[model samples]
Target: MGNSKLYKGSLSTIILKLLSEADKMYGYEITQKVKELTKGELQITEGALYPALHKLEAEGVLEVEVARVDNRLRKYYKLTEKGKEETVSKLKELQDYIANMQVLFNPKFGLES
Candidate 1:
């Protein structure tokens, strides 16, 4: 469950990064994309995902468009210019964090000495 918690904290960044590349996507699509990319290692739950998306939209990092598809209203999310900037910055931050973790995990290179 430790890995799951890590994914939860970074889920917003993941979703934003995916949308940045894909232009626009809906909730299920975002979840599926993450699953496919991670080969089922990571799964984003609706309970965790939708709230983050709503927050991003409210924070102006995402723009939403509603369209009728097969008699159902589907909301699509796309990044704004601010969102694109944030995506780049967030990705860099996440990369740095991962690198730091790697150092800790690699005994030969870690701060253990």
Candidate 2:
């Protein structure tokens, strides 16, 4: 399995969380932020990122703004009101998942009878 496969399920959540904090971001900015936060361990490819962004926009969770930058149109994404609410839910879910995974993967965690 490739590195991206590990983070495939959490892509939308990650994007949402970032937008919640940053208010707005372009595609490349999102990718770079993720890379910076993860210390280069994870990279979001265009193939994965655009589709996810489009889906969220369709779902009314994200709002898009287009601006001309350096002779090109740059699309920026920000969380809608619904997305802000969803961000809190998704973050709680992610935290619970991490805690569960820790218990399952760590041999010394909750192993005593």
Candidate 3:
């Protein structure tokens, strides 16, 4: 529970990357996928997840489709063309950031020269 807070920052990036891999996905599906992929290291809360989804949708980076499933309305999100391009750049940016963080966190392993 305590360690969960540490993952808060990466949630958006994670969600974006996941949506990039395919066409679209639903809220519960995203949560389940993240849990399965991370082996429980990250559990996205509804509060955090929905807000990010809404923000992305509002930003026009994502397209939303509402459909009836099991007699209930389900909203699915898919990346727009812009989102596809953005995903590539965002992933590269995130990769570099993580690499730098690794070097900073493990000074002994980083190049001294």
Candidate 4:
């Protein structure tokens, strides 16, 4: 949950994009993958991760599968067909946000002087 505020709004989109790339992933795995991808700069805490996951599940954007692995039950999540479509939309939205932020903060590239 490092810098949680900075990442709060994008959590679901991040999860959806990850599930879109992978066949399935468990909660802990998702956290680790994000840490690895971000070089440990960002951490997804359970408090934030689970609620977003559940919301996506409730929205029919995700499917869950439970399996017993090493004597422990693990819940894996994958994207539904609707989630696949939503991932594209979310990605585009994120990209647009980034571009706008860059222009806003880096005035040399902005239209206004």
Top model number, TM-score:
4
lDDT: worst 10-residue window of model 4: 104-113
What does the lDDT come to for candidate 3?
Answer: 0.84
Residue 105's lDDT within candidate 1 is 86
Q: List the residue pairs that clash in candidate 3.
A: none
Cα RMSDs, all models: 2.8, 2.4, 2.2, 2.3
Across 3-83, the per-residue lDDT of candidate 1 in tens digits comes to 378898898899889998897999999989988888888888889889999999998999999999999999999999999
For 1-113, candidate 3 gives per-residue lDDT tens digits of 42375577767678889998878899999998998887887778788899988988888778999999999999999999887887788789888987788889998646863
TM-score of 3: 0.87
Give the candidate number with the greatest lDDT: 4
1 versus 3: better TM-score goes to: 1
lDDT of 1 at 95: 91
Better-scoring candidate (TM-score), 2 or 4: 4
Per-model TM-score versus the true fold: 0.91, 0.90, 0.87, 0.92
lDDT of 2 by residue, 22-60 (tens): 979999999999999888888888999999999999999
- Candidate 4: tens digits of C-alpha lDDT, residues 26-97: 999999999999999998989999999999999999999999999999999999999999999999999999
Clashes of each: 0, 0, 0, 0
TM-score, ranked from best to worst: 4, 1, 2, 3
TM-score of 4: 0.92
In order, what lDDT does every prediction score? 0.90, 0.91, 0.84, 0.93
lDDT of predicted model 1? 0.90
